[model samples]
Each structure stands twice: as C-alpha cells, then as structure tokens.
Target: MMENRNLFLAILLSIGVLGLWEYFYGAPQREKAQQIAEQQRIERGVDQNAAQGAAPGAQVPSNPAGAPTAPAVVANPGVTREQAIAETKRIPIDTPRLKGSIDLTGGRIDDIALKDYRETVEPNSPNIVLLTPPGGPQPFYAEYGWVGAAGTTAPLPGANTVWTQEGSGALTASTPITLSWNNGQGLTFKRTISVDVNYMFTVADRVENAGSAAVTLHPYALVSRHGRPHVSGYYILHEGLLGWLGDDGLQEIKYSTIEEEKSISHRAKEGWLGITDKYWATALVPPRGEEFTGRFSAVTNQVPIYQTDYLLNAREVAPGGSTEVKGELFAGAKEVRVINEYQNNLGIPRFELMIDWGWFYFLTKPMFWLIDFFFHLVGNFGVAILIVTVLVKLVFFPLANKSYESMSKMKKIQPELTAMRDRFKDDKVAQQKAMMDLYKKEKINPAAGCLPILIQIPVFFSLYKVIFITIEMRHAPFFGWIRDLSAPDPTTIFNLFGLIPYDPASLPVIGPFLMLGVWPLIMGVTMFLQMRLNPLPPDPTQAMLFTWMPVFFTFLLASFPAGLVIYWSWNNTLSILQQAAIMKRQGVKVELWDNIRGLFRRKPRTQE
Candidate 1:
C-alpha cells in the first residue's frame, strides 16, 4: 500500500506537469479588436515621419534616420500575393532549397518559398511560402540598406528607391546579385546579396564616397510583416518576435505583447532578431563585432504590421574611402543542423534559439539529435524513435533494476506489512514507525517504487517537445496509415478508421474527445495493463484512480502528436515486461494474469 501510494504520487506529479503544459499550450486566447478603416490603413506608415503618399512604398523601419521612408500603402480592396509580386520588378532567386525573388524597387528579399518543404504532406501541395511582397495577405520580407546618421539627409535609398541590378542571371547559391542605388550626392549604396546552399543569405553593403565631404551613415536591416501572421498558439513554441542580444540574453516578445508595448529596443554589440513561425523563420544578423540597436515594433491597423530591425553604429566614410558592412539574413525552414552549422561556421550568436527549444533545451535538443541520428542510420524515423527508446532504457537500466528490485521486495513483504498495520490500527504514528522499521530491516526503499515514474516525466516531455517542435519530424512517416508524425494520429476509432466516412470531430462540445485515434487507444491499453501488473490498491479511491487514469490520458492525449503517443505506448509496454521480469527474479508473485482474471470473476455475496 505504501509502494502504491508512492507510485500514485509520482503519477500525480506527471499528470500535474502534463496538465500545466496543456493548459498553456493547447488553448488559444481570442481578443476583440476593431478593424482600421481602409483610409486609415493607407495612412498608417511605419513611423509618423515616414512618407505616406509615395507611388510604390516598401515596408519601412521606424525612425530610420529620416531615410527614404515607406511609400504610402495603397489600399487595394482585394490584393493577392501574386498581384503584389507582379507589381514589383524582381530579380529571380532560384536555389536548391529556396525559390524567391528580390524586389528591385526596394532591393528587398521579399518573395521566398521553401523548395524542400510543402504546405501539406501531399506531394502536389504548394511550397511553403516564407516571405511575400508588401500589400499581400502576409507581407513578409527582409530589407538591407544604409541609413543616414542623425542630422544627415542624404537622399538615402528608401522604399521608393529603384536599385539597379548589376547582373541579369537569377540569384542562386553560386550567383550573387548586386543592387546599387545612387543618392546623386557622395554616397553610392551597393547591396550585394548572396545565398548559401541552405538558408543563410549574406548581404554586403558597400558605400562609395564619390563626391566626398566625409559622411556618417548607419547600416540597417529589417524583416517586416505587413499583417499579423497566423501563429500556432502554443506556449511551448514561440511563434512571434524573438532575439538574442549580446548582453541581455534572449528576448521573446509575442505579437500581442509587442502591440501592447509598441516597441522593444536593445543596444547590443552582437545579436540577431527575427519573426518566427513554428517551422519557418526570417532573421537579421547585424554586422559582426558592431554595436547596434535592435528593435521589435508593430503598427496596429486593421491589418497589423510587425517589424524586427537593427541599426548599426555610425560608420564615418572618409572622402575617397569606401565603407562596407556585411550582415546575414536567415530565411527558410528551421532545420536544426542547418541552423547549427550557420551558428558554428559563421558565428551567429545563439542562432539555434530561433527554434524555441523551450526550458529543456539541454535535454530536448540532444533527444532530437539522437533520434535524428538513428533516423539516418535506420532510414525510418519511427524505427529511430523505438531504437532511441531502447537505448534510453539500457542507459538507465541499473537505476531501474534497483528500483524494481526494491518494489519486488516490498510486494513480497505485503502480508507482513498488512499484519503490522492491523495490529497497530489504533495508533497511526505507531503504524508508520513499525512499517519504517520493517522496511529498514528488509533493506527496502519505499520511495524506490516512484523512481521509474519520476524518471519518465522529463524524458517523456523532452520527446514530446522534440516531436512537436522539430522540423525533421514534420512530415515523417511511420508505417501504413501513419504519416506526418508531428500531427495527431489520423485514424480515429470513432469513425472506424474512416470506414464510416463521417467526420466525428466536426461535432461540437465533445467533438475533440471523439477523435480518439488508434495509437492513443494502444497507449491506453498498455497503460491499463501496466497498472494491472501491480496488485489493486486496497483503498477504493486509489484503486478507482489507478483504473481510470489510462482512460483519462487516452482522452487527453488523443490529440497529441502520433510520434509521442507511439513512444508512450512503447515505453509502457517495455516497463511492464521489465517489472514482470524483476518480480519473477525476486520470487514475488507476478499478479498480472491473476489481476486480469479477477476483473471478470464474480465475488460471492457476504450477507443477505
């Protein structure tokens, strides 16, 4: 009974963790906001001084040293991304992993699509659009250029500035494009944008002091989104603006938080800032070894615009001397290896943080990497998960063995313990002391029974985090009828695995619970069997709890990722076998079969 109580406490701890996790991540907050009128939307620029009546405006950064400001937002009643792209003169960008174009009007990397990823698991599904031109449904793009220092109005390149591309070929991994704009003054701004085989884009801005009164200019880069992006409303994954500043550590500001505050600014020697989705991101890495002010700001209109930008320190371009500042932009799918490579090779500060590894970064990332390694070796992610689980069990085998051994010893002495309790029924303190004495004499640790359950909590959550957040698991397949491991199991028992062809999840109220899938059912059954391996608790409330927890979890976790459900079910099965083996070795009764039969057997009536 003590052992059962300890187990019960450990299970409750696990449940508490899961409940808290679900409470924050599983629910969305809906806020009521008024829509800005069409005229107001058109009038709203990045800042008050930003030009509002320009013909072709770009998404401008706020207080950009009074540089060429955003062109007035022309409100087209029904504007599509395609129409927005057509409006701009673009230099084609075609790479192995990415396909997009640079908007020549603003010299912004506006239109980008991930070539290796799709909007859906279907092969014919459209490529995942990462960046889009302005005035579209989701106006997202990265712009890099030079802004004049405080009092210098040098007719700097702004949204309306038309840059001249030096070469005609499409921008590829090997081919770099240079867009140059002249101020008709001394400064000639040339931005050469180059991309790697992966997602990193290197933008080197060179300013030529031709006319030559020494001038001061600040280099700036920004990622702008014209409308509020549809986020994956989960606390576990940050799907808004986040960055790692030099001294300030990491700052993650949600869209709503940013809107409320208007702007968050940090002056750092080195850092990166960006807007991130669950699977994709676009970031601005300021020039290395330079002090810059990074700001995340939003302008709330009917359709809000969010921006993350950095303005580097003033660079004094001497007469007849040129100044060059090189920065990088990461715009693509957040693949762990790729992000890590850029961080290690190019020395981007805390760039891997863009993936939102959560509080368990130490455990979660390694778990993901291990599973990924096994995936490469086995050629199947599901097989990799199983292999990793076995490895984890092996690694913790000694601890588990001792824990089970203690549990088996405790179980074997249950008769003596029960007798002791009955003998001391009138004195509760005496009962506890005698039990402690008995346990000490038997060399049994009552807390040892909870060890296995305690060990499971972090590992379980780490695996969940890896599966839920990693891009590698996004469309990974397991076996027949199990595709997209990151998504919930699609085969729901309520629909007889789709034989009925009616969507049970469409119903209201109980609709979500009704979508209980096959893997969750298997997990529930394994959980039930695992619990039945132990003797039913003598306390009726505890017994009832032990019996129904599996069902409760089944309903609760039916909507979890298929991979997590698979891991949980597999882990439970392994634990049962391990416990049974230990019990047999310790000369304790393996009551699993007896417990199963007892559930069906009828008890004779005592008194009529």
Candidate 2:
C-alpha cells in the first residue's frame, strides 16, 4: 500500500516536471515556425514575379508584337498552354458582358446604369461576373463586355430591376437588388442579389416560359471572395453539398455534383438548388413554372448533400404563367453558426459533423444538444460541459458501484484464488478452471471490471466530437491567460536551440504546460490508487503491465485539447473517490503498507 501511494506521488511529480519543460519550450518554436511560413510565402511571391517573363527590374511591355507572347516553358513547369486553351473551351459559349456598376462606398445604395459598368475582374477569373440588360429597350453590353458563341445576349433584353435596403444602420449601404427579365419570345426571368449582410451575400434567379412552347435556358452561378478572387476556398453547392473550389483542400469526405444534361432548364418540378466552393456553400429552391420547367443543379464533390424538403425541379409554366426561385448564400468563416444557419434556411438538411468515422457524431448529437440547452440556461459552455460530465458520471454510478463492490468481494477471496493456484501449480488449465468455478460460486462476474472502461470509450469519443465541431467554444476565452479555447494550450518556454517543434509566444510557457502538468499527475495518482484498491491479477508481469495505463494515456493525450484532458482527469479523480467510498461502505480497510507486504514483500515458499 505504501508502494502504491509512493508510485502515485512519483508519477504526479514526473508529470509536473514534464509540464514545466513543455511550457518553457512551446512558444518560441511556434514563433519560429510562423517565421518560416512567412518566409516561404515571400519566396512564392518572388517565384510568381520571376515567372511573369518580364526582364529583371523592367516593367512588362503593354503590347506584344502580335498575339500575347507565350512565356518559354522553363524546366519542370507544370502549367501548359494546352491546359489554359482547354479551359477556355469550357467557358460558357453564351457568356454575357457586364451592364451596370454600383459603388456604395460613400454609404449610399445608388445604382449606376449598366452603361457605366466596368470590368473589375479578369476574363479568366474563377468566377465570371457578366452584366447585360436585365430587361430593357435593347440589349447593350457595358465597357469590357464580350459576346459569346451562343448569341443569347449577355443579359436578356427588357429587364426591370428593383433595389432596396436591408437590415438596420448603413454598414456600407446594404441592398437586396432584384432584376426581372423577359425574352421577347415569352421567357421571363428574375434574378435577385442579397448583399452586404454582415459578411454574407446571396444571388438567386428564376425563369418562366410565357409562350406556347417550352424553352431551354442554361443555369450557371459563379462566386468568389470580394477581393481575393484567386485564393482557393471551400464552398457548398447546396446546404449540405460541401466541396473544394480548388484541389488545395481535401478532408477525405464524399460529395456530389449535377450532370451536364441537367444544367439546361425547361421548367419542371419546384425543388432545391446548391453549390459549394473550397470552404463555404449556397442553397436555394425555385417555385414551379407555368409552361416550361427548369432544373436546379446542386454542384459539389467533397461533403454529402442533405436534401431539402422542397422539390428539386422547377415547375412547368403554361402560356402566360410564371415561376419563383428562392435561394440563400451563407458566406462567412467555417463556424458552426454559418453551417447551422445554412441548414435551417428553406428547410435544407443539416450537415452532420463527423470525426473518427461517423460514430462520434452519430452518438453525440443528442448529448451535445442537451449540453447546449443547459449552456443556454447557464450562459456558459464550460459549465455546461461540467454539468454534462456530472450527469454522465451519475448515470453510470450504479454500474460503477456494483463493479467496485464486486472488486472488493474479489479482493477478499484473493487468498482462496491464490491457494487454488498453488494447489494446481503444475496444471495451468486446472488453475484457471478452478478460479472460474470459484468466481461462479461466489456470484462474482469476472467481466465486471470492463464495464466502466467500455462505457468511457463512447463518452470520450462523443466529447471529442463536440469539442471539434462546436463553434461556441471558438475563441471563447477561459480564466486568466487562457485565450482561444479552439487552439492548443498556449504555454511557452524558450529553447536556446530549435530542439522541440512547437510555438512559444501565443502559447507562452504557462497554460499548456500547466494543463499537461497537473492533469497527468492527477491521472497517475488516481490510477495508482485504483490499482492499489482493486484485486490483483494472477500474473505479476501482467499486473505490472496494466499499471502503465496512466503513463501511456498521458503521452497519448499530451497535445490533445486541454479542456478534454481536464475533463478526463476530473473523471478519473471522481472514479477514485467512488471506489474509495465503495470500500469504506463495505468496511474494507485498505491497510495501506500492510497490503503491500502481504502482496509483494513475501518470499516464495520452496519445498523439495
């Protein structure tokens, strides 16, 4: 018993020492890594400059001798002229030109006629923004507009547009602009842009046939960041259809896209539409048409699509009939609110947050929601986690109590099990069978020890899922010096040399180190106490092997989220207390050092 207590203390001391070391080393390394990343970014910029084919320190000439001169292919150049030329063929043959411009920089939502619009983005920009008459006297292309092969005329003629303010207080003159278009042959079109809404923007369009025959109109949408048009980002084709705009990001998930034949509209059922970029997404549904039906494409290839309650096809509009298409775009950081808002909009399906396969999310949503509800009541996520943890512990209390009670009963019978082992020393099988029989006679379930640990597996996984997906914890600071709960614990210690690869500044040498420091020590102490209190295994080597569990767990969790470790350590502490209570209730004296003597300090009796 003394040895067990001493082992617990020793383990705690070791963890504290490691924590101090980690704290001192974490920050500076992180700063060093950041510096390296910045350097690489600068180098990449320089490489791009070098690839532009301009003479060293000379300005690029405005015009080439004839067509633009292709840069000579340098060794190992991955980009090719054929690739660029092939991409051009994919551009919509009937692409339209810009027709109008709006400058709301002065805190006013005033419209500049389409005639005054200028091209702000290059033709090859990932997103193609075209402006043509929504519905006007004649189709006119604005400055920097080019005609495409389809001859559909960039903007359909005779379009009427309406613009109105949205939300309160002018935050850069917010507006919801709607444009109504009519093709003389009886094709009616309406497109709306909901913009400047707290970093979110949306564009939706609808088309209806008014003539006797059905007409086919191709539907296309392009989106990009306001200023950073070239950076590859994630986007959702539909509410749940998540995908990457570029190949730069792949989270090893499944997604879907629409077929090309479905891109053309002739008016059909009224349903959902969606698309995803590298990081964000958009979802919408269009109303039925009168004569012709339209198809809504939900394009993506990274995340699964959660189908909307609305129909997927536009309704067929009859002669002198119409259709309505509605859509909402969620543009923001990859936060939970962004995802939840998108899921709630227009009855779209929610994206299931996944981790370690789907098991964690599949098991934790109910528990997480419960935690969230209580969090709302108390107004604190941390406290909510604590409450949930307590609830979980209480729920398992009966089983745990039974297990400990059985364990105590087994400890009391250890002398008999050992005696059987000695009697059957030469026959291992007989020894094991005798023990099994003894357990059966004693009404003790040998497997009881596995119950608590088995239950912990799911609980641990669920907690991990919640921590990984919940945006409520993002940047939510805790008590003193612990900022940014979403990130690793920031405890820094400077190293004279770059020996350990971790950051130190933001992680300064306190928070992370202390977290790692105290929890593992507590875990080790609890584990030692538990080992001392429980019945020992028959095999001395096996028992020693089991004793390493705390050490292994500490190492495994060294860099995990600090909050999770805190919960685990607290849980272990509670378990220890529970076990101790069980022993006291049964009037089982631990007998500390005396128990150690009876167990380990005995010499084997030899008889010849």
Candidate 3:
C-alpha cells in the first residue's frame, strides 16, 4: 500500500515537472527554424522588397549574384493585407538541383547548373571547356560563361557550338540524363541516365535495330573534365555483413586509366562513367563515322569518401548495340532508400547480408522482414516501433506465461520453504538439500524459472541490434507532437525559475516536459503495478541478475531512436494490463481507494 501511494505521488510530480519543461523549452526552437526560413525569404527579396513600386522608366535588372531583382509595380490599386499574405503563402520551398537531361544523337547537353557553376568559379574566360569525341577529334569550346540560378542566361562569345536549353525535361537539369542515338545501320537506341543525389550517374541502355546486319559493336564512351590532370578517388557501398545490397547489385570489374594504375571498379562490367562531386560536365563526340558509341565522366573538386582511391571512369558505348549502365550520385545525404531505388532501377541486385547462423537465418531474418514490412506500412516510425514491440511481446508470450506459472508455484511453496529453513536454522546446506528433495518429490521442475531468464539475454541483444542499425528508422516521423523519430522528445515545459525557455525548432516546451517528466513517472507507476501483479519470488541472486535487465536496457536505450522509446512506453502499459488480467484470474483483490489510503497513511519504518 505504501509503495502504491509513493508511486502515485511520483507520477503526479513527474507530470508537473514535464508540463513545466514543455512550457519553457520546446516551442521556441521550432519557431526559430521557421523564423530562420522566414528571414531567408526576406533576404531573398520574396517579402516586402517584392512589393515596392519601381520609378517610372526604371526597370529592375537580374542581379549577377543569382538573386531576382524585383520589378516594382506602379501604385494603381491598393492591395489588402489579406492579398499580400496569400501571395506570400503561395511561395514554395526551394530544393536545389531539381532535375537533368542529355541528347545523344543531337550531341547537346542542356540544363547545366550554370548558376551553381558560377557560384563555384570566378567569371574568367581563361577556364577551358573540354568535350570528348566518340572516336575522332576532341573539340574544345572556349569558356564563354557567366550565369547564376538567379541570373539571366549569359550570352555566348562565339558561334553556338554547344549550349543549354531551358525547359522542364532539359538534359542538364534533373538527374540521370536521358538520351537517344541512331547509327547508319538503321538502329536507334534510347537510354536513361540517373545519378545518385551524390552525383554518381548511371546509364541504362535500350537499342532497337531497323536494319538487320547482325551488327555488334563493343561500346566505349568518354566525356572530358578539364583541369590539370591528377589522380582521382572512388568507393562503393557494397553488400557485406551490413552492405548486402550494394555488393550483390554491382558487377565486379577492373580498369586502368591513363592517370592511374589498375584497380577493381563497382561500375558494371561493360563500363559506366560517373562523378561523385562536380557541378558541370560536357560530352562532345565529334563524328565517329556513323557506328559511334561512348560514355561521359564527371569530376568534382572534393570527393566524399572515407577510404582510398576516389575516381569514377568514363563508360563505353557501342553503335547498333546497347547496354544499360547505372550511375548513382549522392549530393544531399547518404540515405539508403534513395541509393536502393537508383540501384534497383539500374537492374542491380538488392543489398543483402550474409548471416549463415541457422537460428539467425530462421528467426532474425523473418523478424527483420516483419519489422521492415511494418515500417513500410505505417510510414510513421513510432507506430512501426510500437507494432514491432507488440509483435515481440506476442512472440515471447508463451515463455512469459511459463515463467509466471513457475513464480506462482514458487509462491505456493514459500510457506513450506520457510518451515524447513526455520527447522534447520543452523544447517543451511541441509536446509537447501531438504528443500530440493521436497521439490523433487513434488514433481516440480526447479529450473523452470531459469530457462526464461536465460533466454532473455540473447533475445534482448538481437532486438537491440535490429533497432539500432535498421535503416528504416532514419528520418521516419511519428504523429502529432513527435516529429522526427531519430530526435529526442521536443517538449521542454518550464525552467528552474518560473520563466519558460522556448525552443521553437521543436514543439512548445510542453513536449519535452511531458516526455521527460511525466513519461518517466508513468513508467515508474506502471512498473509498480506490474510488480504487484507478477511478483518475483524473493531471491537475492535472482534479484541481482534481474536488476541488470532494466539497467542494461535503460543504458542501451539511451541512444536509441525516440520512436523506440514511445513503443517501449506503450509496451509497458500493455504489460501492466496483461499482468493485471493475470492477477485478476488468480483471484487477487485490488481495492483502489483502500490501496491509495494505505499508501499515504503508512509511515516508513526506522531501524531500531
């Protein structure tokens, strides 16, 4: 009863603390992000600056910095506040490097990131524009470029040998440039180029022959990146213990470049050109006598690889013959889903891990698959976590039932054990022997309780591994209040003083306060309820062993995704219900009001 009262008080205090923290910490952080974005918009001249009227005969010109210069509207009709707000609300979030394209037969690369290019380089005419021909002469286009994402197109200095076309499906904009080619053999080919957001591009080829001459051409393609030549670097996310997908999908091949020694390549056996870092690239195939085919290579200033050798070579293409080679380029983040999609589209095998352990193969894989499926279904990581938790509970329900039954049997024998201990007060060994004999005579298996406890260790570790490394949890969100599953609960309600430290990036301080304060308290109370219903037999050794369960788990969960915590909290509540149901079935009486009164009334006993 005292325990119950203490638990209730703890819960109330926790709720109060959580509420205060949320008020103080959470709200301001989220507001800060919104504020930053708003400020960026204003800086971008999307707000008030856009509304100012221009002087008569003065036109706003495009700024060289790639920012739009607002054309002032003459004051004709007064605009209302609501109208301005609606206009502002229509602004879309800007996502860079939106899309790209390429024209194979026409030999034109359009929609280049000239704006991004200009930011990276100075406006100098000395920089060379290099383009590689399929088999013939190399053509050099003089650098006549100055353009920005926010700037108007720069006029070319010489005749238009090559240039970009502005359109939705232009070659240089969206990723994985798509192109087509036709040779004199009357064969036409269509190919799609996809680069990972990382800038690793892949080419998928499809060829159709109009004239049947049993034509076969070994495909080889090359595109030039101009600069003083130097050694490059490269790396592939392969399929292994953890990299199952990348390894199996890519064909093993080796290559020797004029710039470096021979090494293994993740690029397909037929050769695929790609660049990991770089803003602009050009392909110039100056007439290779109609049977032409080739590929292009992109270069960047800095390579994004942890290991040695960073280089992606140019791929080869053949006339009257076609093969699809996929290139994946990563720019923003090294996310697995985006990588997997591009790899799969290139007809690469899915990433798979090699774990031949029989039990792991039988159990862990199925469990992972189920978890993955649930992750896909709900989309919200927290909900997926809850589902996985429930599934795990259901799977272990039988073991728990057996353990509970053993505890019940132990409780029944407590009186008998006490009698034997009292009778042999001075002979501990003899008492234990007598107790064992009585147990054997009663046909009770003394080890029943031990099996469940023993099995939990490995199961716990396995589940821990799954939750910690599973890619599905990355960037996944929960419902209202909790946005990012990977991040901590945002509600920080109150401060040490009465003031609230608001974090606008997250929910109002209320979120963290409830999560940190109220949540722990709820957990404690639920734990108390669980203890009452499924009480463990009083054994110091078992108690010490079981203590590690919570301690180790709490430590392990400290770095775990918040989604997992939510699942665990819900799981604890469910466990309490299960135990309470079991206790009710065993005829245990639970008087709510009496329990509460007894808890408050009882005073702690002091040692004499």
Candidate 4:
C-alpha cells in the first residue's frame, strides 16, 4: 500500500508540474510571441488578403536583392479561381491521384487538386485543393525558369512570356508535354514536363543559343505560396517552409519566422526544398550532385509571398551550343511509405523526414509500420489498433504475469505488513529494514507493479505521435460516430451523448472540460476496475487519491484522439482480466468484489 501510494504521488506530481508549466510558462510565451508578430506584420503593411488579388500570368518579379516580388500588374479584386484559369492558356494535367492544369504562361505547374482526398468527410465533398494558380483567391504554385546574366541580352522567360505547346496530347504519365519559346534574338528555349502516376513532375529545360556571343544563365525552381495559409498553430506539428538539404539535414522555418528574418539561405550539393502544409507539401528537387543555393524567403509587398527556391550554378551556352537541366517537383500528400520509396529509389535525401515523427522516431516509425501492417490485414484502422493493443499485451505478458503474481502475494500478506508497521510505528528506519526482510523472505518485489506501467509510457506516447502525424490516419473511421481517427470523440455527455440538442464544445472556459465522451467513460470504468484488483488503501487520504485517479485520467484523455482512447480502454480491460486470472491461479482470493461491496455498503453506526 505504501509503495502504491508513493507511485501515485509521483504520477500526480509529474502531471501537476507539466500542467503548471504549460499554463504558466508555455501558453503565455506563445501568446506574447504571437502578439509581437502580429504587431510587426501590421507595421509592415502586410495585407493578409493581398494574394487573392494577384494577376494571372504574373511571374515572381526579380528584385535587386534577389527576393521574390509581387506581380507587375495588380490583380483585379473579386477574381475567382475559374476566372484566373480562364485568363491563361493551360495544359491539362491528368494522373491517377491528381487533377489540375499546367499554366502555359511562365510554364508553371499550378492549379493542382488532390483526387484521393476531400475537404470534408462527407461523400461528394470537393477534392482538396493543393495548389492554385496566380491571381486565384489563394495563389500557391511551383514555377521553373531561367534568369539571364547581368550583361546577357537574351530574353529569358518572364511573367508575360507565353510558351507554345509542341505536342497535341494532354500531359499524362505516358504522354509528356513540351513547350517552346523563341526570344527572336537567336535564342530558343524548350521545357518538357512529365508527371508520374503519383504526384512527381519532372521538368527538363533546354536552352539553344544561336546568337553571335555566348550567354550565361542560371536555372531556378521555386515553390511559392502567396499570403499565409491557415495553420493549426500546434507546437507539436510543423506547418510551414521546410526542406532536406544534403549533409545539412532538415531545415524547418515557420511563416512568421521567415517574415521576421526576411530570408534564410542554405548551400547544398544536392537537395530538395519546399513549402509544407499540415497534410500536403510542394517541393523542388534539384539535379543530383549539382551545387545549388536554396532560399526560404518572405517577400513583403502589396501581395506578400513565401517562397522556397533554389538556383543552380550558371551554365554558359556558346554560339550554336545547347544545354539542358533536369529537375523534379513533388506536389501531393506526405504519405510515409511513398516518401520512403522515393528516398530509396530516386535518391532523394531524407524525404521521409518531411513528416514530423517527433523525437521518438525510432519507436514512432516502427509502431506506425506495425499498425499499418495489421491495417492491411484487417481492412480497418480501428480494428487494427485493437489488434495491435492485444499484441502488445501479449508481448509483455510474462513481465505482467510476474508483476501481478507479486502483487497477489503482497495482498495475501497485508495483515502481516500492517502488524509490522504498527510494531515499528516509532522507528521509521527499522520499519523499512524489517519490510525489506519480509519482502526478501516472501520472494516478492514491492516495486514490481510499476514495471508494466513504466514500459507503457513510451509505447503510449509513440502511438499517439504516429496517429497524430501520419496522413493515413486522416479521416479514418472506427465503428460509428467516429469518422476521423485524428479527431477527438464527437459525442459528449454534456449533450447526453447527442440525445440533447446543444454543443458543449461551444461554451466558454468550462466547455472543453465538459467534453466527456463515451469512449473516455468506458476507459475510466476499465481503469477503476483494474484498480479494484488490489485491496483498497487503508489510509483515508490514500484511498481517496486512488479512487479519484481514474476519474482524473478519464477527463485528461477526453480530448485525445478517439482511437487512442479506445486503445487505452481496451488495454485496461485486458489487464484486469489477466490480473484476475493470475490472482486466482496464485491461490489468492481476488478482493475486487469485496472492494466494490465496501464502496456501497452502509457503515455501522459508531457507539458515540
């Protein structure tokens, strides 16, 4: 009982420390930083809706400092996406998992929509819009072009340069499209774009110089997002500009950070850089083993834009000479297995790092694969999670058996322990020594009960990270009323489990506190039953703490993902059953029913 009390106290202390730290330190710091950033943005005249008014066919204007610039022609207000697509000539993009168009002007691969995903879980919902063309309500696009040298007279492709399609068929995995432009100064440029069945687009740019003098130019690719997009503002997940620079590892910069710093530069021999949202990402991969400069910048203007760009070394084309550069763009969901395949087959460095797997990558990634394997076999993620929990329990069955057996022995010797404690009430050191002797004689480990719990801490945290960060868990359904595994359970007791007609989540202060869902209730019940496996603590304070722990945990886990809560409830039930069986086999009477009866039984009146 003392050991149990100590463990409970330790757990409570840790929780209190974390709660106080988050409320007193972390939340205030984040709020203050956000306020300062908002003030800075206002001082810079940053218009949040400036990107909505960008003109179609507007290329990133080159600034003297080499930062991205707003459109030369001001965008007309109230222009819709349909209007923007209609304003420019485009080549249709058809793929198994994507649908959109490639803008002919400036040869940008913009206007992309994810076919496999939707904006909502409802059937027939609109497909998720990943990228939109310039001048659209939200301008997010990827553009590849060349920059002319300081003294070169060659007219490189700019915002207004329109390319003529050299082919007749639409751009598909099997059919690539080639666009050509002639500067009329004896310089001919051709861009051939090819997309795979997935989201990768390969761009091959060739330059033929027929002029009398040699020309020097630099090829560059950029993934630019005009205006800041909506973010979940979660500290655990990163949603902004990020990239994998070879040997430099991963570089993640928030939009606000970019705005404050103006720009960030990284030199790499070969790498990929891009802008990342919570679910989708757009990255540009330069040619392998090629020296390049990557920059993440926020260009402040009428329509401020955040850009992830890279410029390769200059290539000189002499008279009647030609040069070609090959690069690739990844625009789609950040699927773990798909990214890993690209990293292995295509030699893309650290592509899997795109997902925020957190600090426990070793445990989190393997746990994801284990769950994924079962998901394939079971055909449902919810069922797979249950099976995974069972497997984990089975794996630690031996250790848990030992712990439970020790606990049963301790319970059987409760009378002897109490008597010893009374005899040594005035001698604390002697009591501990005698207790240790008794433990040795009984061949019992008083601390054994904590082993299983300690082992579960990392596994629990890793599973949470996997479920929260992986795209596969998005919109995944369990049985019913749980459409999205990444979200908390929808049904709350405050509305009588949806039998009533009110939303407690909308209330202030106490709203989130009242969100005790069905699964959390089930979990709390299981936890309470598990605690009943041992006799109730003798001390009044200890008994009260033990009784309230389950209720505390239930409310604490109410806001977690439904899938996680389900796992916890299932795991606790299994533990209770296993402990009961073990206690019976050890020839010890289980005190669970007696404890429950004691809870409701009327106490005999004292002779006052």
List runs of model 2 lying over 4 Å from the truth: 1-175, 178-190, 195-216, 223-324, 333-345, 350-357, 492-517, 535-540, 591-608
- Clash number for each model: 1, 73, 93, 0
Candidate 2: lDDT of 312?
Answer: 31
Off by over 4 Å in 1: 1-4, 14-18, 29-71, 74-77, 601-608
lDDT of 4 at 493: 90
> Model 4: runs farther than 4 Å from truth?
4-6, 13-77, 300-304, 600-608
- lDDT: the better of candidates 2 and 4: 4
- C-alpha lDDT values of all predictions: 0.82, 0.42, 0.37, 0.81
How do the predictions measure up, each by TM-score? Answer: 0.91, 0.56, 0.46, 0.91
lDDT of 3 at 383: 65
> If both were scored by lDDT, which would come out higher, candidate 3 or candidate 4?
4
Put down candidate 1 lDDT per residue, 261-344, tens digits, no spaces.
Answer: 877789899889999989999999987898888888877654567788888878998888998999999999999999998889
Whole-model lDDT, candidate 4?
Answer: 0.81
lDDT of 3 at 140: 14
Clashing pairs in 4: none
Residue pairs in candidate 1 whose N, alpha carbon or C atoms collide under 3 angstroms: 57-71
- Candidate 4 local Cα displacement, residue 98, angstroms: 0.6
Give the Å error, residue 176, model 3.
7.5
Reference-based lDDT, residue 289, model 3: 22
TM-score of 4: 0.91
